[model samples]
Target: MSEENKQIAQELIDAVGGLENISSVAHCATRLRIMVKDKEKIDQNRAEDIDKVKGAYYNAGQYQVIFGTGTVNRIYEQFIALGAPESTKSEQKEETKKQGNKFQQIIRTFGDIFVPIIPVLVATGLFMGLRGLVTQEEILALFGTSPDALSDNFMLYTQVLTDTAFAFLPALVAWSAFRVFGGSPVIGIVLGLMLVNPELPNAYAVGEGEADPLMFLGFIPVVGYQGSVLPAFIAGFLGAKLEKWLRQRVAESLDLILTPFLTLLIMITGALLVIGPIFSAVEAAIMAGTTFVLQLPFGLSGLLVGGLHQVIVITGVHHIFNLFEIQLLADDGMNPFNALITAGIAAQGGAALAVALKTRSKKLKALAFPSSISAFLGITEPAIFGVNLRYIKPFAMALIGGAAGGFFAALFNLEASGMAITVIPGSLLYVYDFVPLMLYVITNVIALGTAFVLTWMFGFSDKMLEEVKTE
Candidate 1:
């Protein structure tokens, strides 16, 4: 490692309050995820204030500090240099289980697990969308008049890659969460796999009308904990605690065989019997609350599509909406969330594009442009972080544009036939749906274009661009 890199990493560790303060640490493709014992100890606002720090968030039980691509590696090297091991720590012997503030803990745990996995999820989602284009019969039929004979290879390939992520994602999250809580990753992975595996469908009663499949052990009362953002987190938290408790009682010599076996037995059982019900109730309540909000008198659909979508984007829990969309499609023949996401993407992209054109700083313009373009294509993370997020004006512009778009969609009583991107080419499959294909295309284009125009007219400042670029 370069001495300079080591020095920077050490400084980061020190700034965050030494290696001991860390419960667990990991990195995504771009950010460093640090789970600390106490959020109060770290100056989150100060970290964000640093010119070098791109963004910082405290969510789902984890404290996240974002750095551009290469920063995580540098931080990791420094962590090693400071004699702090990269692997998770052994489970701490004693934890007070009196259950503190339940809501806050759940949020923190959710953040720790989900924020790091977002890049992979987005990549896979985009890939799945592309694969649909390659395999759709009508698309291929357009090329060669034989609709029925269109090849399934593209669809198959996409399905396999996409399913691999979805099928095993619980395991992936569990591994990350366990590490966050400072426990054995292997055991956590096993627990996650158990939750998502289809063959052993765990059953959960989600009220009177719905019987949601738990998809793990039948013992859990919560439904569809598989691929669930919260349950995996709760499982990891409980799993880590259970593992630690077992580790203390077993003799050192028999630890190797007994520790894992006993931990698995206890954690899995505990998860199914206790943790699942509690988490399921919480999930049910949140969904119920959101649904209730959508029933409000003040154009509930527009408010939800515009306001809640923004909140989810910031917390990075927006991915949860994908599952909800799929569920709605399967159950209700329509999905409001899908429409909202499409509109949100258009709004965000438009705002970024507007800012890009108005900014005189060549570097800021360069960064903002590509990020905005990608946002139009339905991947908004880059734009959200690199462009619109910090620019107060752009985000507001996007939200207003999004609200306008979503309100139009709801007014027309539009419904997507399937999950598809809002872009012109991607909306081809929804051509025959309740909302005409032409309207869908025009709505997104207008929303995005209007946002860009408004951003330029009201929010543009070359000085602001220069300040951001120089910093």
Candidate 2:
């Protein structure tokens, strides 16, 4: 392979004493990480010299080569073609569970389970925002009609758009959790449906006292788990474990019929009767904890969370927010986390823009400009590791700007119609209401402008340009 990407991969293999030295390999958003048979066999200096390789380091028993966003995936494709072990970031994450502490493993599992489901939530948020705008009294006045003038079918369509995801959310969560935890996804889906079955009293209506709950075994109150997150996730996990256990002992002659039959019967019974009650309490505690943080006095919640959100990104565990945001929405009917996080994300783009504008180095200019564009579009990995973090002061300046924006968001009591996105795309969540839309615009302006002015003024200087120029 004479192509540039292939050459990079070939050289990387050579630097690590050829492909034979590689035990396994994987990559994350920005780096290609490899475990080798002998650290002594690797030529670290030579590896760093390769094109598109921004830097190199050894950490946590893996030799990490920083290739920066899109470049890493291309180089990894070449690496795999050259006879290295085939792997993915998800598999890399799975390996981490074996090596990390319990809390870390749990976070990884949460990421694995929820990452696939976030897009649906984001789309639901967008539809909710659109439906809100279309249904508004002021908006309908332009059309010479009112919400009361709308037909029942039109209203039902709006409910389908905004409410279906949350309505069947438990099934989605259980299916994903079951897949992640190694069980039949179909079974998880069925169990989840049972949680929200029409045969049972609706959870929301029961909470509102419009319907009485079904009493199980004389004392336990039972209702549908509509919109619940943790209960479904835990049920899926325990069910997957039981299925695996059953598979090991069930005879080959009757494995198919007995294992699935027995597994479903026991899991559904246990979930409704015993397991569901336990996680319902756990879910409430989690909701309370996030609520406490969101309501911290005087915008302290926004300041702390926004300022530190990117810091958490650096550790690669930020997907943990998915669990919290969904729970917050289920409980509060609005998502303040969406408003709180966008400010920080906007600051990241701002910092990168400042660096791109101020830097004389062509290489730094090349990296910072596109990275800034991506950060604005709600993907900050490139902007972060490629530009701002490379210049320490820009990142710190951005944090201050984020804190400033977050303070205003909380103080204004701003809430979004959605989550799972931020910055430019995140603007969708605020469009339903004029006042909150203005507040959202102001939040980004403050964040972007603050970081821009700070970084252009003092965060960057001509001195740092020399290293970037040479590299």
Candidate 3:
């Protein structure tokens, strides 16, 4: 660690009660989340005032001190060096599960399940966007070929690159959910695969009436769960619980065979007969509602979604939006959701930069600058948690900025070909058209500039810096 980081780490340890009060220490993307034995022992204000500490808050029995990305890991290492008990993410999760209320535990479970699976979707979304770009008429015209005239092998390659993840999405969801719920991921994956078996008609094909659903017991219809999420999650949860129950009852010698066998058989039957149909209907309803909201007149949908999207992120349920975006891409080949989401993300960056420019403390500036840059490059957690949300007015200004940008995006009917990756990288999703591309740029500029100007005008002051320095 750098000398500066080491100094900041020692200061942080002192501010948080010199390590004695901390039961366990862990770090996430941008914060040192410490479970303290006694919250009263820590100097919360002093922690927030520390050089590298951007903000501090207590939530769900953990004291989270914002340190911003690379800095957090170093601080965490420093804690370990100081003999603090290190905690893994799973352990922290279990701690929260034990301490939090039912709703909080459910949200935490969702975060645990989805956080690990997001990278796969993000990578796939990027490939999907690039595939759209390469196949666009303008790009293809450069190669002197129309869509029909493109080489079959080239199209085959693109299909392989882009379609595989969506085709097997259920398995991915099931595996992650199983891991989160404390079940064997391999068994979960097998159960997920069975839901999407080749023997059954594909979900999309069934929807399009191109194939028939399989009849079970003369009347119950069963279809493959291709591109589905909810059924897999439900199946994984029930399967995990069932597996545990079976393990407790069955003899240890027979557990290896009977546990998985019964878990698969019972879960698969339940999925096909109950979970799939019910949750599929529920998912359809949600998609319809989201589509209707986004389609509202005069850009109202965009304004509302863009302004409050980050609030959803704060609640840790934003991963649910992934399902909506993926469904939009599957059904319509366009995702307006990405444009609005980008507006919100860009606004956060703008607000953070404003705070960076306004703050007199070199430490605050250092923390805010890279986080702003990260936000523009399609990651906003550092910006939001480390800077903007730390100050209430900046967050509010960012929301207004996002609203303005989103209104424009909706007015232009701007859409992206992919679900993930925003701001500069999001441009790839709009490469098919020059108008949409320019609109994307304009949206980001409006978001960033508005937030920057608003924050500069009202978000920060000399008084706040004086207080920090004194602390």
Give the least accurate 10-residue stretch of model 1, judged by summed lDDT: 89-98
lDDT of 3 by residue, 239-317 (tens): 8888888999999999999999999999999999999989988888988999999998999987998899998887655
Predicted candidate 2 versus true structure: per-residue lDDT over 1-471, tens digit per residue: 339899999999999888888878998887898877778988865775566766566544567887877888899998999899966766665555675467766787898898888888889889888888898999999999998999999989988988888888989999998899899999889989988888889989988999998889898877888889988998899888888899999998999899889878998888888777778888889888888899999999889987889999877678799999987777655899887788888998999999998888676677788878888998776677767876678899989888989999999989998898788888899888889889999999998888889999988886865554455
Q: Name the candidate, 1 or 3, with the larger lDDT value.
A: 3
TM-score of 3: 0.92
Angstrom error of the Cα, residue 393, model 3: value is 1.9
What TM-score goes with each of the models?
A: 0.60, 0.90, 0.92
Worst 10 residues of 2 by lDDT: 53-62
Better of 2 and 3 by TM-score: 3
lDDT of each: 0.63, 0.84, 0.84
Q: Please, what are the lDDT tens digits per residue for candidate 1 over residues 11-43?
A: 667666777887767666666667667777776
lDDT score, residue 295, model 1? 48
Once model 1 is optimally superposed onto the true structure by TM-score, how far is the C-alpha of residue 128 displaced, in angstroms? 5.3
Error of 1 at 123 (Å): 5.9
Give residue 324's lDDT in candidate 2 (0 to 100).
90
